[model samples]
Target: MRIDTRVEINAPASLVREKLLAFSEHADWNPFFTSIELVGCDIRDSDSQVKPGDRLKVSMKDVRSGKVSTFTPTVLSCTAKKFEWRGSLIGQWFFSGIHTFEFLEKDDSQKCVLLHHETFSGIAIPLLRPLLKGTQTNFEAMNNALIEVCENGC
Candidate 1:
């Protein structure tokens, strides 16, 4: 199963990408992902940049229930145009999700489109399907918040 959401922001792709990767600043704008901390890295070091193999402790809030769940996901890729991570519950065979953020620049324009998605797999998907119903809306809320931050000079 997958949950994908997209939003167009009136900001340069570079700016959007920068803000997206700025994990330290996520709490200021991201509603779904309330907090993201680089694991094994000092939180005080605001300059820390995430790279492949890095692990992150993320706190996510359910938009509908206001419930928060924390998980540690390993960074799969971090690049100028994309960021991806993989998180598993118990084991990969049990449940896992590959989350990605992709930035696409509009043709010859300063605006950009952001694609936020997560691909879920494993045996638990069928049982967990109902819980995922509100995920799309949560992602949309985060995307809109990103637009606010990027366009308002964050």
Candidate 2:
């Protein structure tokens, strides 16, 4: 299953990327990720940018069910315009996914075109499909929340 969504924000891509990469401030604007913390490294002492080796302690709340789940996923790749990461699961073959957030700049405008997508392909996908309600809605909510933060103030 794949849930891909995007939204355009009236802000520079640089600013949008900055806001997205700000892990500490996620709770204020990020609806899904209530908590995002760097693991095994202190923000004050570590580099102030996303890197492949970085690990994140994430807390995500289900938009439909109001249930919160926690997981730690390592950074797979990070660039100025894109960031991607594989999902976190104890049983890798049972459930797996990849999440990618992208910022595509408009040629003559400061608008930030953001693409947020996730793909799930695993043995448990069919069995767990019933529990995946509001997945697309959740992405839309997150994207709108991001727009608010970028357009107003992050």
lDDT of 1 by residue, 9-103 (tens): 99998889888777778888899999988889545444236788889999999878999999999999988788899999999899999999998
Q: How well does model 2 score by local distance difference test?
A: 0.82
Candidate 1 stretches greater than 4 Å from native: 41-48
> What TM-score number comes out for model 1?
0.92
**What tens digits encode model 2's per-residue C-alpha lDDT throughout 3-66?**
8898889999888888888877888998888887778965554223768877888888887788
Query: Which prediction has the highest lDDT against the true structure?
Result: 1
Candidate 1 local Cα displacement, residue 46, angstroms? 5.0
